[model samples]
Target: MAAENRAFVGSIVVAGAILVAGSPFLMGFLQKWESGKARVLVVYADPLAGGLPTVCNGLTRHVTSTPIIVGERWTDEQCDAEERSAVVAVQKRLAPCFKRPPSQMVFDMATSHAWNLGPAATCGSGAMTAWNRGQWTLGCQRIARGDDGTLVWSYTCKTVGGQRQCTFVQGLANRRADEAQTCGEVL
Candidate 1:
């Protein structure tokens, strides 16, 4: 009975060690799977009238808590600073669950463009305009066409932005570029 108890304790210790060591990888795997399925988990760090968006798949998910009042105003510096801070905070929170560091994440900025054009729309035009200036950064698998006309995947990250915001840009390179550019111009 004594020997059996010792063996059980040893097994439990080994299992605990394994769980601790494997936690990061497990979190990364779960995050990748959730992101792949186009589900974004949004975290809001500010209590003011500001927020940002993170892209899941090629779609944008807003992180705001309330409806944006049209005709409101903010300085360009404020907008930029607020946006940068929000994005960095979100990335930091997600970093632990990523296989690599947050710097290596490939976020889709195009999704931010889409959001500004719709839900996060601004009514004013100026340096401190009432714009929804949310930025995005993440690591993602790039999709490209192969010789057989099938999709090929590669891992990469990119910086995408406009006058007021940015987000992770996912999809084929040429197509994403065109769409992002067009959206930026409109914003």
Candidate 2:
């Protein structure tokens, strides 16, 4: 595999030292926004629409070693390990989608999106398309919204009143807006 593809698969040895994929800022961003600290370290039903049994910095079976059981608890060490594992897994899967090295801002924004949505959704998004085309600002705009001003990923299928429907979430909107603002810093 190419050097970039090897990134996030695991720490790479360079100059006799190991380094992760992105800057420390990326990990801090995830740790802060995903979860501040493992208060309980127990799996709980996430409040987001279509949310899964998430624990420890938004970990799910999709990116975990095993299925998450509701009410089950994990140690701080385990939670921390899984958090790193999940982020690296996401970066490994999504790395191939970038035809070129994206700006740090775009990379962070897209990785955050892929962390929430699957890499498949992110790879197929207009933001990814723009990034691959070397349109950083457009990619950031698409991350905030779609091709239009409508929010790109601020809704999810939520069952309410015995009916499943797409529900708009202000938290998600705010998160995307924050991502856009961060992306704008690079412009």
- Please report the candidate that would top TM-score against the real structure: 2
Local distance difference test, each candidate: 0.27, 0.72
How many collisions per candidate?
15, 0
Off by over 4 Å in 2: 1-22, 37-40, 49-51, 158-164
Best by lDDT: 2
The all-Cα superposition gives candidate 1 an RMSD in Å to the true structure of 19.8
Query: Which regions of candidate 1 fall more than 4 Å away from where they truly are?
Result: 1-61, 64-67, 102-187
Q: Give Cα distance to truth, residue 11, candidate 2, Å.
A: 5.6
Q: Global lDDT for candidate 2? A: 0.72
Q: For model 2, how does the per-residue alpha-carbon lDDT over 114-182 read when each residue is reduced to its tens digit?
A: 888889988998888987897888888887797758887888786689998887888788878877778
lDDT of 2 at 58: 77
What TM-score does candidate 2 get on C-alpha atoms?
Answer: 0.80
